[model samples]
Target: MTTPRRFDGRRALVTGGSRGIGEGIARRLAAEGAHVIVAGRSLGPAQEVAGEIGGSAVQMDISDAEATMAAVAALGPLDVLVNNAGFDDFAYFTDTAPQQWRALLGTNLEGMFACTHAALPAMQQAGYGRILNIGSEAGRIGSKGNAVYATTKAGIIGFSKSIARENARYGITCNTLAVGPIDTPLTDAARAVPVHGEKMVQAMKDGTLLRRLGTTEEVGAAAAFLCAEEASFVTAECLGVSGGMGISA
Candidate 1:
Protein backbone atom coordinates (compact mmCIF):
# COMPACT_ATOMS: atom_id res chain seq x y z
CA MET A 1 0.00 0.00 0.00
CA THR A 2 1.12 3.53 -0.67
CA THR A 3 1.90 5.74 2.28
CA PRO A 4 -0.51 8.56 2.93
CA ARG A 5 0.51 12.09 2.15
CA ARG A 6 0.91 13.90 5.44
CA PHE A 7 -1.50 16.65 4.44
CA ASP A 8 -3.26 15.47 1.33
CA GLY A 9 -6.57 17.18 0.64
CA ARG A 10 -6.00 19.55 3.52
CA ARG A 11 -6.55 23.29 3.57
CA ALA A 12 -4.23 25.45 5.67
CA LEU A 13 -4.24 29.11 6.66
CA VAL A 14 -0.98 30.80 7.71
CA THR A 15 -1.00 34.29 9.14
CA GLY A 16 1.90 36.68 8.35
CA GLY A 17 2.77 34.25 5.60
CA SER A 18 4.05 36.86 3.20
CA ARG A 19 7.64 36.63 4.28
CA GLY A 20 10.18 35.27 6.74
CA ILE A 21 9.28 32.22 8.81
CA GLY A 22 5.58 32.48 8.03
CA GLU A 23 6.21 32.40 4.32
CA GLY A 24 8.53 29.43 4.73
CA ILE A 25 5.87 27.51 6.63
CA ALA A 26 3.27 28.26 4.00
CA ARG A 27 5.45 26.96 1.20
CA ARG A 28 6.31 23.82 3.14
CA LEU A 29 2.64 23.05 3.83
CA ALA A 30 1.79 23.50 0.18
CA ALA A 31 4.63 21.21 -0.82
CA GLU A 32 3.14 18.57 1.45
CA GLY A 33 -0.09 18.73 -0.57
CA ALA A 34 -2.14 21.22 1.39
CA HIS A 35 -3.95 24.17 -0.07
CA VAL A 36 -2.36 27.16 1.66
CA ILE A 37 -3.93 30.56 2.20
CA VAL A 38 -1.37 33.27 2.95
CA ALA A 39 -2.55 36.22 5.02
CA GLY A 40 -0.66 39.36 5.95
CA ARG A 41 -1.04 43.11 6.43
CA SER A 42 -0.13 43.84 2.82
CA LEU A 43 -1.65 42.27 -0.25
CA GLY A 44 1.35 42.85 -2.48
CA PRO A 45 3.81 40.80 -0.47
CA ALA A 46 1.27 38.18 0.51
CA GLN A 47 0.15 37.71 -3.07
CA GLU A 48 3.72 37.49 -4.26
CA VAL A 49 4.50 34.68 -1.84
CA ALA A 50 1.25 32.91 -2.64
CA GLY A 51 1.89 33.14 -6.32
CA GLU A 52 5.31 31.63 -5.91
CA ILE A 53 3.85 28.69 -4.03
CA GLY A 54 0.64 28.36 -5.99
CA GLY A 55 -1.36 29.24 -2.91
CA SER A 56 -4.11 31.80 -2.28
CA ALA A 57 -3.54 35.17 -0.62
CA VAL A 58 -5.64 37.41 1.59
CA GLN A 59 -4.65 40.78 3.02
CA MET A 60 -5.31 41.12 6.71
CA ASP A 61 -3.86 42.63 9.85
CA ILE A 62 -3.98 40.01 12.53
CA SER A 63 -3.68 42.83 15.04
CA ASP A 64 -7.29 43.78 14.29
CA ALA A 65 -9.71 41.50 16.12
CA GLU A 66 -12.57 42.20 13.75
CA ALA A 67 -10.43 41.57 10.70
CA THR A 68 -9.05 38.33 12.12
CA MET A 69 -12.55 37.12 12.96
CA ALA A 70 -13.83 38.03 9.55
CA ALA A 71 -10.96 36.31 7.82
CA VAL A 72 -11.52 33.14 9.81
CA ALA A 73 -15.22 33.20 9.06
CA ALA A 74 -14.54 33.70 5.39
CA LEU A 75 -12.04 30.86 5.23
CA GLY A 76 -14.61 28.41 6.54
CA PRO A 77 -13.40 24.99 7.70
CA LEU A 78 -9.63 24.65 7.95
CA ASP A 79 -7.44 21.61 8.40
CA VAL A 80 -4.60 23.69 9.74
CA LEU A 81 -4.08 27.14 11.21
CA VAL A 82 -0.58 28.53 11.76
CA ASN A 83 -0.65 31.59 14.01
CA ASN A 84 2.62 33.00 12.73
CA ALA A 85 1.75 36.69 12.78
CA GLY A 86 3.20 38.58 15.73
CA PHE A 87 4.64 41.95 16.77
CA ASP A 88 7.71 42.86 18.74
CA ASP A 89 9.28 45.97 20.23
CA PHE A 90 12.88 45.77 21.30
CA ALA A 91 12.70 47.97 24.37
CA TYR A 92 13.56 47.70 28.02
CA PHE A 93 10.53 47.13 30.23
CA THR A 94 11.09 50.56 31.75
CA ASP A 95 11.35 52.24 28.38
CA THR A 96 8.26 50.54 26.91
CA ALA A 97 5.35 52.94 26.55
CA PRO A 98 1.88 51.94 27.65
CA GLN A 99 0.50 52.41 24.15
CA GLN A 100 3.26 50.32 22.65
CA TRP A 101 2.61 47.59 25.14
CA ARG A 102 -1.02 47.48 24.11
CA ALA A 103 -0.13 47.35 20.44
CA LEU A 104 2.45 44.63 20.96
CA LEU A 105 0.22 42.48 23.12
CA GLY A 106 -2.74 43.12 20.84
CA THR A 107 -0.98 41.62 17.85
CA ASN A 108 0.94 38.89 19.62
CA LEU A 109 -1.60 37.58 22.12
CA GLU A 110 -4.98 39.12 21.42
CA GLY A 111 -4.68 38.65 17.70
CA MET A 112 -3.80 35.01 18.14
CA PHE A 113 -6.77 34.57 20.42
CA ALA A 114 -9.17 36.11 17.95
CA CYS A 115 -8.01 33.94 15.09
CA THR A 116 -8.07 30.78 17.16
CA HIS A 117 -11.47 31.60 18.63
CA ALA A 118 -12.93 32.20 15.21
CA ALA A 119 -11.38 29.02 13.80
CA LEU A 120 -12.63 26.80 16.62
CA PRO A 121 -16.15 26.33 15.39
CA ALA A 122 -15.05 25.25 11.97
CA MET A 123 -12.45 22.91 13.42
CA GLN A 124 -14.86 21.42 15.92
CA GLN A 125 -17.42 20.82 13.21
CA ALA A 126 -14.88 19.29 10.88
CA GLY A 127 -13.40 17.11 13.67
CA TYR A 128 -9.82 17.65 12.53
CA GLY A 129 -7.51 20.56 12.93
CA ARG A 130 -3.87 21.45 13.49
CA ILE A 131 -2.88 24.71 15.15
CA LEU A 132 0.74 25.84 15.28
CA ASN A 133 1.83 29.03 16.97
CA ILE A 134 5.19 30.57 16.13
CA GLY A 135 6.84 31.44 19.39
CA SER A 136 10.44 32.39 20.29
CA GLU A 137 13.34 31.17 22.37
CA ALA A 138 13.33 34.54 24.07
CA GLY A 139 9.92 33.62 25.45
CA ARG A 140 11.42 30.59 27.08
CA ILE A 141 14.65 32.03 28.45
CA GLY A 142 14.02 35.79 28.27
CA SER A 143 16.21 38.39 26.58
CA LYS A 144 17.64 41.86 27.10
CA GLY A 145 15.99 44.89 25.54
CA ASN A 146 12.99 42.79 24.59
CA ALA A 147 10.97 42.30 27.74
CA VAL A 148 7.60 42.84 26.11
CA TYR A 149 8.47 40.70 23.15
CA ALA A 150 9.54 37.88 25.40
CA THR A 151 6.39 38.13 27.48
CA THR A 152 4.14 38.04 24.48
CA LYS A 153 5.87 35.00 23.06
CA ALA A 154 5.68 33.31 26.44
CA GLY A 155 1.97 34.01 26.52
CA ILE A 156 1.54 32.09 23.27
CA ILE A 157 2.91 28.94 24.84
CA GLY A 158 0.44 29.10 27.69
CA PHE A 159 -2.45 29.97 25.42
CA SER A 160 -1.68 27.12 23.07
CA LYS A 161 -1.54 24.61 25.91
CA SER A 162 -4.95 25.67 27.15
CA ILE A 163 -6.46 25.32 23.71
CA ALA A 164 -4.83 21.92 23.26
CA ARG A 165 -6.24 20.57 26.51
CA GLU A 166 -9.73 21.82 25.72
CA ASN A 167 -9.74 20.51 22.17
CA ALA A 168 -8.04 17.14 22.57
CA ARG A 169 -11.32 15.31 22.37
CA TYR A 170 -12.19 17.07 19.16
CA GLY A 171 -9.15 15.79 17.25
CA ILE A 172 -7.62 19.27 17.35
CA THR A 173 -3.96 19.79 18.16
CA CYS A 174 -2.53 23.09 19.31
CA ASN A 175 1.21 23.46 19.77
CA THR A 176 3.83 26.17 19.77
CA LEU A 177 7.23 26.16 18.12
CA ALA A 178 9.79 28.21 19.98
CA VAL A 179 12.15 29.40 17.31
CA GLY A 180 15.68 30.74 17.78
CA PRO A 181 17.44 33.36 15.73
CA ILE A 182 17.23 33.03 11.99
CA ASP A 183 18.51 35.03 9.05
CA THR A 184 15.47 36.98 7.92
CA PRO A 185 14.41 40.39 6.75
CA LEU A 186 13.60 41.33 10.31
CA THR A 187 17.10 40.55 11.44
CA ASP A 188 18.63 42.03 8.34
CA ALA A 189 16.86 45.28 8.98
CA ALA A 190 17.95 45.31 12.58
CA ARG A 191 21.53 44.61 11.63
CA ALA A 192 21.54 47.32 9.05
CA VAL A 193 22.30 49.74 11.87
CA PRO A 194 25.73 50.03 13.45
CA VAL A 195 26.18 49.24 17.13
CA HIS A 196 22.79 47.76 17.95
CA GLY A 197 22.74 45.59 14.86
CA GLU A 198 26.19 44.20 15.39
CA LYS A 199 25.50 43.47 19.02
CA MET A 200 22.27 41.67 18.21
CA VAL A 201 23.87 39.45 15.61
CA GLN A 202 26.83 38.51 17.81
CA ALA A 203 24.59 37.76 20.77
CA MET A 204 22.35 35.52 18.72
CA LYS A 205 25.26 33.51 17.42
CA ASP A 206 26.80 33.23 20.86
CA GLY A 207 23.56 32.04 22.42
CA THR A 208 22.97 29.27 19.91
CA LEU A 209 24.49 25.86 20.52
CA LEU A 210 25.32 25.58 16.85
CA ARG A 211 27.16 28.88 16.84
CA ARG A 212 25.13 29.71 13.76
CA LEU A 213 21.67 31.06 13.21
CA GLY A 214 18.74 28.88 12.19
CA THR A 215 17.40 28.58 8.65
CA THR A 216 13.93 29.20 7.21
CA GLU A 217 13.95 25.69 5.74
CA GLU A 218 14.56 24.17 9.15
CA VAL A 219 11.68 26.03 10.77
CA GLY A 220 9.46 25.17 7.83
CA ALA A 221 10.14 21.48 8.29
CA ALA A 222 9.16 21.60 11.93
CA ALA A 223 5.97 23.49 11.14
CA ALA A 224 5.03 21.10 8.38
CA PHE A 225 5.32 18.11 10.67
CA LEU A 226 3.23 19.73 13.37
CA CYS A 227 0.50 20.45 10.84
CA ALA A 228 0.56 16.90 9.48
CA GLU A 229 -2.04 14.21 10.14
CA GLU A 230 0.55 12.03 11.83
CA ALA A 231 1.05 14.67 14.48
CA SER A 232 -2.53 14.31 15.75
CA PHE A 233 -1.32 12.77 18.96
CA VAL A 234 1.02 15.65 19.66
CA THR A 235 -0.71 18.49 21.47
CA ALA A 236 -0.29 20.94 24.29
CA GLU A 237 3.45 20.73 23.79
CA CYS A 238 6.20 23.28 23.21
CA LEU A 239 8.71 22.22 20.60
CA GLY A 240 11.94 24.12 20.35
CA VAL A 241 13.22 24.72 16.88
CA SER A 242 16.19 26.49 18.42
CA GLY A 243 19.65 25.10 17.94
CA GLY A 244 19.93 23.99 21.55
CA MET A 245 19.96 27.53 22.81
CA GLY A 246 17.19 28.43 25.26
CA ILE A 247 15.05 25.35 25.85
CA SER A 248 12.40 26.07 28.44
CA ALA A 249 8.87 27.49 28.77
Candidate 2:
Protein backbone atom coordinates (compact mmCIF):
# COMPACT_ATOMS: atom_id res chain seq x y z
CA MET A 1 0.00 0.00 0.00
CA THR A 2 1.15 3.52 -0.73
CA THR A 3 0.29 6.80 1.00
CA PRO A 4 -1.51 9.38 -1.09
CA ARG A 5 0.23 12.52 -2.22
CA ARG A 6 -2.67 14.93 -2.19
CA PHE A 7 -0.97 18.15 -3.23
CA ASP A 8 2.35 17.16 -4.71
CA GLY A 9 3.74 19.83 -7.03
CA ARG A 10 0.80 22.10 -6.21
CA ARG A 11 1.22 25.73 -5.20
CA ALA A 12 -0.94 27.37 -2.55
CA LEU A 13 -1.48 30.86 -1.13
CA VAL A 14 -2.87 31.14 2.39
CA THR A 15 -3.81 34.53 3.80
CA GLY A 16 -3.53 35.20 7.57
CA GLY A 17 -1.42 32.09 7.90
CA SER A 18 0.43 33.47 10.90
CA ARG A 19 -1.75 31.81 13.49
CA GLY A 20 -4.94 29.93 14.41
CA ILE A 21 -6.95 28.26 11.67
CA GLY A 22 -4.93 29.86 8.91
CA GLU A 23 -1.67 28.62 10.38
CA GLY A 24 -3.09 25.13 10.73
CA ILE A 25 -4.20 25.11 7.10
CA ALA A 26 -0.86 26.40 5.83
CA ARG A 27 1.01 23.80 7.84
CA ARG A 28 -1.20 20.99 6.57
CA LEU A 29 -0.84 22.07 2.94
CA ALA A 30 2.92 22.26 3.21
CA ALA A 31 2.99 18.85 4.85
CA GLU A 32 0.98 17.47 1.94
CA GLY A 33 3.66 18.74 -0.46
CA ALA A 34 2.21 22.06 -1.61
CA HIS A 35 4.54 24.98 -2.00
CA VAL A 36 2.70 27.36 0.31
CA ILE A 37 2.94 31.14 0.42
CA VAL A 38 1.58 32.90 3.48
CA ALA A 39 0.50 36.54 3.41
CA GLY A 40 -0.44 38.89 6.23
CA ARG A 41 -0.48 42.57 7.15
CA SER A 42 2.24 41.91 9.73
CA LEU A 43 5.65 40.62 8.72
CA GLY A 44 7.22 39.38 11.94
CA PRO A 45 4.58 36.86 12.87
CA ALA A 46 4.13 35.83 9.26
CA GLN A 47 7.84 35.21 8.95
CA GLU A 48 7.87 33.11 12.10
CA VAL A 49 5.05 30.87 10.91
CA ALA A 50 6.55 30.58 7.44
CA GLY A 51 9.87 29.63 8.93
CA GLU A 52 8.26 27.01 11.14
CA ILE A 53 6.29 25.51 8.23
CA GLY A 54 9.16 25.82 5.75
CA GLY A 55 7.04 28.02 3.50
CA SER A 56 7.54 31.49 2.04
CA ALA A 57 6.00 34.67 3.49
CA VAL A 58 4.74 37.88 1.94
CA GLN A 59 3.42 40.95 3.76
CA MET A 60 0.34 42.53 2.24
CA ASP A 61 -2.89 43.97 3.60
CA ILE A 62 -5.64 42.12 1.80
CA SER A 63 -8.08 44.98 2.42
CA ASP A 64 -6.09 47.19 0.07
CA ALA A 65 -6.96 46.43 -3.56
CA GLU A 66 -3.73 47.62 -5.09
CA ALA A 67 -1.61 45.81 -2.56
CA THR A 68 -3.58 42.57 -2.90
CA MET A 69 -3.44 42.62 -6.69
CA ALA A 70 0.24 43.41 -6.73
CA ALA A 71 1.04 40.68 -4.23
CA VAL A 72 -1.04 38.07 -6.04
CA ALA A 73 0.48 39.06 -9.37
CA ALA A 74 3.93 38.57 -7.94
CA LEU A 75 3.03 35.03 -6.90
CA GLY A 76 2.36 34.17 -10.55
CA PRO A 77 0.22 31.03 -10.87
CA LEU A 78 -1.39 29.39 -7.85
CA ASP A 79 -3.23 26.10 -7.61
CA VAL A 80 -5.10 26.94 -4.41
CA LEU A 81 -5.92 30.18 -2.63
CA VAL A 82 -7.19 30.09 0.94
CA ASN A 83 -8.90 33.39 1.77
CA ASN A 84 -8.52 33.08 5.53
CA ALA A 85 -7.51 36.61 6.39
CA GLY A 86 -10.50 38.16 8.17
CA PHE A 87 -11.52 40.17 11.26
CA ASP A 88 -14.73 40.40 13.25
CA ASP A 89 -16.30 43.28 15.14
CA PHE A 90 -19.04 41.77 17.26
CA ALA A 91 -21.70 44.23 18.37
CA TYR A 92 -25.39 45.07 18.04
CA PHE A 93 -26.01 46.85 14.75
CA THR A 94 -26.99 49.99 16.66
CA ASP A 95 -23.72 49.99 18.58
CA THR A 96 -21.54 49.74 15.50
CA ALA A 97 -20.14 53.02 14.18
CA PRO A 98 -19.83 53.94 10.54
CA GLN A 99 -16.06 53.66 10.66
CA GLN A 100 -16.17 50.23 12.26
CA TRP A 101 -18.63 48.91 9.74
CA ARG A 102 -16.55 50.28 6.91
CA ALA A 103 -13.44 48.70 8.34
CA LEU A 104 -15.15 45.34 8.73
CA LEU A 105 -16.47 45.32 5.19
CA GLY A 106 -13.13 46.52 3.88
CA THR A 107 -11.23 43.68 5.51
CA ASN A 108 -13.81 40.90 5.31
CA LEU A 109 -15.59 41.44 2.02
CA GLU A 110 -13.58 43.81 -0.16
CA GLY A 111 -10.31 42.14 0.75
CA MET A 112 -11.57 38.76 -0.40
CA PHE A 113 -12.92 40.26 -3.62
CA ALA A 114 -9.59 41.79 -4.48
CA CYS A 115 -7.62 38.61 -3.87
CA THR A 116 -10.09 36.44 -5.79
CA HIS A 117 -10.10 38.87 -8.73
CA ALA A 118 -6.35 38.98 -8.81
CA ALA A 119 -6.02 35.17 -8.71
CA LEU A 120 -8.65 34.53 -11.40
CA PRO A 121 -6.68 35.51 -14.49
CA ALA A 122 -3.86 33.09 -13.80
CA MET A 123 -6.23 30.32 -12.78
CA GLN A 124 -8.31 30.77 -15.90
CA GLN A 125 -5.20 30.67 -18.04
CA ALA A 126 -4.02 27.50 -16.33
CA GLY A 127 -7.49 25.95 -16.54
CA TYR A 128 -7.75 24.96 -12.89
CA GLY A 129 -7.95 26.54 -9.44
CA ARG A 130 -9.40 26.09 -5.98
CA ILE A 131 -10.54 29.00 -3.80
CA LEU A 132 -11.69 28.41 -0.25
CA ASN A 133 -13.16 31.25 1.77
CA ILE A 134 -13.22 31.06 5.57
CA GLY A 135 -16.66 32.12 6.67
CA SER A 136 -18.54 31.85 10.00
CA GLU A 137 -21.62 30.12 11.36
CA ALA A 138 -22.87 33.55 12.38
CA GLY A 139 -23.68 34.06 8.71
CA ARG A 140 -25.66 30.83 8.52
CA ILE A 141 -27.79 31.80 11.50
CA GLY A 142 -27.78 35.50 12.26
CA SER A 143 -26.13 36.39 15.56
CA LYS A 144 -27.69 38.91 17.92
CA GLY A 145 -24.61 40.98 18.71
CA ASN A 146 -22.75 39.97 15.56
CA ALA A 147 -24.86 41.71 12.97
CA VAL A 148 -21.95 43.26 11.13
CA TYR A 149 -19.88 40.12 11.32
CA ALA A 150 -22.80 38.01 10.09
CA THR A 151 -23.38 40.36 7.18
CA THR A 152 -19.81 40.06 5.98
CA LYS A 153 -19.80 36.27 6.25
CA ALA A 154 -23.10 36.07 4.44
CA GLY A 155 -21.52 38.25 1.77
CA ILE A 156 -18.72 35.69 1.44
CA ILE A 157 -21.22 32.93 0.73
CA GLY A 158 -22.87 35.03 -1.96
CA PHE A 159 -19.55 36.00 -3.47
CA SER A 160 -18.36 32.41 -3.56
CA LYS A 161 -21.56 31.24 -5.23
CA SER A 162 -21.19 33.94 -7.86
CA ILE A 163 -17.60 32.94 -8.43
CA ALA A 164 -18.65 29.33 -8.91
CA ARG A 165 -21.28 30.25 -11.47
CA GLU A 166 -18.92 32.46 -13.44
CA ASN A 167 -15.73 30.43 -13.20
CA ALA A 168 -16.79 26.78 -13.35
CA ARG A 169 -16.31 26.79 -17.08
CA TYR A 170 -12.71 27.80 -16.52
CA GLY A 171 -12.12 24.84 -14.19
CA ILE A 172 -12.24 27.04 -11.11
CA THR A 173 -14.16 26.27 -7.92
CA CYS A 174 -15.07 28.58 -5.07
CA ASN A 175 -16.47 27.50 -1.72
CA THR A 176 -17.04 28.88 1.77
CA LEU A 177 -16.51 26.99 5.00
CA ALA A 178 -18.60 28.55 7.76
CA VAL A 179 -16.76 27.62 10.91
CA GLY A 180 -18.12 27.32 14.44
CA PRO A 181 -16.45 28.65 17.57
CA ILE A 182 -12.90 27.42 17.39
CA ASP A 183 -10.24 27.86 20.04
CA THR A 184 -8.06 30.61 18.59
CA PRO A 185 -6.22 33.76 19.57
CA LEU A 186 -9.21 35.83 18.47
CA THR A 187 -11.55 33.76 20.61
CA ASP A 188 -9.21 34.11 23.58
CA ALA A 189 -9.54 37.88 23.34
CA ALA A 190 -13.30 37.59 23.07
CA ARG A 191 -13.33 35.41 26.16
CA ALA A 192 -11.59 38.12 28.13
CA VAL A 193 -14.59 40.45 27.93
CA PRO A 194 -16.59 40.53 31.16
CA VAL A 195 -20.12 40.75 29.84
CA HIS A 196 -20.53 37.85 27.43
CA GLY A 197 -17.15 36.23 27.85
CA GLU A 198 -17.82 33.25 30.11
CA LYS A 199 -21.29 32.97 28.65
CA MET A 200 -19.74 32.49 25.23
CA VAL A 201 -17.75 29.43 26.24
CA GLN A 202 -20.75 27.95 28.00
CA ALA A 203 -23.09 28.71 25.13
CA MET A 204 -20.73 27.35 22.52
CA LYS A 205 -20.45 24.11 24.47
CA ASP A 206 -24.13 23.84 25.31
CA GLY A 207 -25.45 25.05 21.97
CA THR A 208 -23.63 22.46 19.92
CA LEU A 209 -24.64 18.80 19.83
CA LEU A 210 -21.00 17.88 20.29
CA ARG A 211 -20.84 19.63 23.63
CA ARG A 212 -17.49 21.16 22.76
CA LEU A 213 -15.85 23.75 20.59
CA GLY A 214 -14.03 22.89 17.39
CA THR A 215 -10.26 23.06 17.05
CA THR A 216 -7.86 24.65 14.56
CA GLU A 217 -6.63 21.19 13.50
CA GLU A 218 -10.16 20.07 12.65
CA VAL A 219 -10.80 23.15 10.54
CA GLY A 220 -7.46 22.60 8.85
CA ALA A 221 -8.52 19.10 7.84
CA ALA A 222 -11.69 20.42 6.27
CA ALA A 223 -9.75 23.09 4.40
CA ALA A 224 -7.23 20.58 3.09
CA PHE A 225 -10.05 18.40 1.80
CA LEU A 226 -11.73 21.34 0.06
CA CYS A 227 -8.52 22.24 -1.73
CA ALA A 228 -7.73 18.65 -2.65
CA GLU A 229 -8.13 17.07 -6.07
CA GLU A 230 -11.08 15.08 -4.76
CA ALA A 231 -13.07 18.27 -4.26
CA SER A 232 -12.71 19.50 -7.83
CA PHE A 233 -16.35 18.75 -8.53
CA VAL A 234 -17.61 20.64 -5.52
CA THR A 235 -18.24 24.40 -5.75
CA ALA A 236 -20.65 27.19 -4.89
CA GLU A 237 -21.29 25.38 -1.63
CA CYS A 238 -21.22 26.51 1.99
CA LEU A 239 -19.85 23.71 4.12
CA GLY A 240 -20.17 24.03 7.87
CA VAL A 241 -17.44 22.94 10.21
CA SER A 242 -19.75 23.94 13.03
CA GLY A 243 -20.26 20.82 15.15
CA GLY A 244 -23.90 20.70 14.04
CA MET A 245 -24.60 24.22 15.30
CA GLY A 246 -25.30 25.33 11.75
CA ILE A 247 -27.70 22.44 11.18
CA SER A 248 -30.61 24.69 12.08
CA ALA A 249 -30.31 26.46 8.75
All candidates: CA RMSD (Å)? 2.2, 1.5
Candidate 2 residue lDDT tens string, 14-88? 999989999989988888888889887898888998888778999989879888988898899999999999987
Q: Choose the strongest candidate by TM-score.
A: 2
lDDT of each prediction vs. the true structure?
0.88, 0.89
Best by lDDT: 2
Error of 1 at 196 (Å): 2.2
> What tens digits encode model 1's per-residue C-alpha lDDT throughout 147-247?
88898999999999999999998999999999988888877865765568778877888898898889888999999888899887899988898898874
lDDT of candidate 1 at residue 244, scale 0 to 100: 86
Q: Which ten residues in a row have the lowest lDDT in candidate 1?
A: 1-10
